[model samples]
Target: MSSSSQGEVVYTPQREARSAFPMAAILLVLGVGVLLPMALARGLTTNSELKVVALELCLLGTLAVLLQPFWGLVLVVGLLYVRPEESIAALAGMRFTLLVSLVALASVLAHLFLSREKLVRTPFNVMLLGFAATAILSTVPNWNMAEAVLEISKLVILVLLVLNLVRTPQRYRAFVTTLLVFTAYLALYSIYLYFTGGAMQQGELARSQATGIFSDPNDLAATVAAGLALALVRARNARGLMRLVYLLLAGSQVWAVVLTYSRSGLLSLLLVICGFLICSMRRKAISTVLAVGLGILLFVVAPSRMTDFDRSEASANQRFWLWSDGLQQLYGRPLTGIGYGQFPEINGGWTAHNSFVLCFTELGLPGYFFWMGCLYYCFKRRVPKATPEEESEEEKRDLVGARLALSGFLFSGFWLSRTYVPVLYLLMCLPVAAQIAARGRPGPQQVKGAEWLRDCGRIGLISLGSILLIQLMTDFLK
Candidate 1:
């Protein structure tokens, strides 16, 4: 293969194969799979018995720390979907997510230490570091220092792992594929829940809500919307059966989002559809027509009970109240604001329910700025200048999908406080990886704008626009 070929693109590999790591991980998984059921069958009822099993499991997981950081990424994604404690009452106090996260973290750390490689730097690294620093500083005023620290630490670790591991385009593609598959599984499972009467019921109306990682209907909807955006991109690029497969995935995800009956999710889905149309349709007329058609389809299919634009609904009013209180806090402490995770503590047990508001109120002005800055970079960063012949079909799809994914997240985030989720950080990594990969392609020239002021201006305009939209919504509700 030529050096310029897509197959030849260089990606950093894990440092060493201790040969024992995968064996250890396999043995640990198999041991737990085999022994846990046996223990349960034996009616192990004593606390000591449970403790012994738990200790053995933890020790095995620790021993499974492997040289392959990619495996850690895979493990973390799988772990995100399952909450053992929630699904099993006996393990209610196990803190399974923490345990899985630790194991994944250890694997990545082991790989990095063996490789002696520096962390991959991107344009937003400094911005992210600033945000993390501010968040830590704000923790001093947090309602619960331990909880805040724990939450922030998890976010930091996840962000670092993504930044360091997903360096090349191939890795980014694999990461997104895994994300799409997991999201699809969640969508299918949620539909099953709805059919089985596991969904929320208000009289005869049923609205599907997932469990474990996406327990909240809105969260489930958000993930589905994002995944649908990716599937749309893939469908546009695919041919034959693969195209049909992607379309099926997209359809299923759309169905799951509608089943959630979350207005924000619906709005986000519409925006994502618009993005998809824009990317897939070259002619403006075709794009506009398809978007309108999609809107009509949604109007006809969505359940009126949830889709009836009722501004006076209790949930709608509650969000407004939360925003009002969040704004008040933001104004009162405009510089430093309340500490991390303190909004619910102070606002009568109400969360901000708005990502922008949550950011400003939690980490104050600097946090808000850095957060906006990060988004600006993600959406607006420059890619290597590729000629028509140089840009591959897959590259074009990746670029479009990442942008649409960002759009979906932001649209949904307007009504949900998910600023710190691992998925969000992983999405942010996409464009960075794309840019790096583009630069590595043969015969590519780097175009330089290097205008920080212009970028800052754009970020400011976007932030203001978001605030104006929120204000308009508030006034309309009034």
Candidate 2:
């Protein structure tokens, strides 16, 4: 099956045959080599039996990935978001995260090579590469070379897989669906933890959190905030049962964010709501009512700690000091700044707690330019107006959801050093992916020399404005 430029579904026998043949071959080989052996095993010890099961599952998963690669991408996303290994003791030693990521990367590369597919071209591609280059250059004089390399490699692999795999509207929907489902699961699990006395204690309050990447309540809150935006947008675009499911997911996400008691998270959530109210024309009255109700509920449920913005608040003060340190570091090394992963080492075991600050301070002005340029283009680019018939309303909603997700993440990043997180990179990839998918192929070069220069100038202005805002806030606190 295939889709036309007008979004009509069509059956293509040759394409189906081409796709099915490889999948059938893979299944046959897997059954013969792995599944049959597992089935024939007799009198195996319990541990050995578990090992066999793991191996069988891994082989099956690999086969599926080789056939469609999107499943592999979803698996990697599941690892990053749900992180079952951290909660499931039996799986702790499996290193499934690394295993699955490597498999996905390899499968994606193989598929692209065999299909003679070019990497999807976008302006963000060059900016991402430029950022990676700056990271390498920054590491040249740093002692944390290994850490820098590992982080940069992850970023590169993630970007490549997203750019290459998410080439169709179907794949884009799958990606969004995967994120929403996992986020809902995580939110529900966190809520259960909160009521079960398993929540993590921060000061006098017990805050809900998840395992692995979301272990920090602030991080979890940021994630839920983004998920909330996605759920709302999805619900708007969906029908009947699926719409109900998305609405429930959105509600759970909002509750989960509140449970974290993160000021940044709450602020991010508010921003998402406001963004909807401003951007959504069809349901303005309904959205306004919902927003007001949510605001009231937030005021009632919010912890005093979250509501407090006094300069004497320990966490708030610490963030101000960290911002100051970041600015000082940037000033001290205006050209090269500190190296990647060195912020904690030089700042007494505290991260910058701000993505922009971390990027500017760690990789200096060049890295900042690349990073900001990437973000700027993410919001700047749009689906071509000529393809309006091809770009369905559902696709447009997905684009808006992606933008909202990024906005939520970015707003939360103001109080958390999530510059290197996979979620950030993934959110950055979605808009570009959507634009590419809408065009039905890689679009023409987006940025010219003049456009590049103009972007740089705009980024510079944003940097200056942000610096001024930070300085004023720090001074006011002082």
The lowest-lDDT stretch of 10 consecutive residues in candidate 2 is 6-15
What's the lDDT of the predicted structure labeled candidate 2?
Answer: 0.77
Task: Write the residue-wise lDDT of candidate 2 on 220-293 in tens digits.
Answer: 99988888888888888889999998888888998899899888989898888777765665787877787788
Off by over 4 Å in 1: 1-65, 384-390, 437-461
Best by TM-score: 2
Quote each prediction's TM-score: 0.83, 0.88
How accurate locally, in lDDT, is each candidate?
Answer: 0.72, 0.77
- Estimate, for each residue in 149-207, the C-alpha lDDT of model 1 and write its tens digit: 67767766766666567766677777778878888888999999999979987667677
Position 21, candidate 2: lDDT: 52
For candidate 1, the clash count comes to: 0
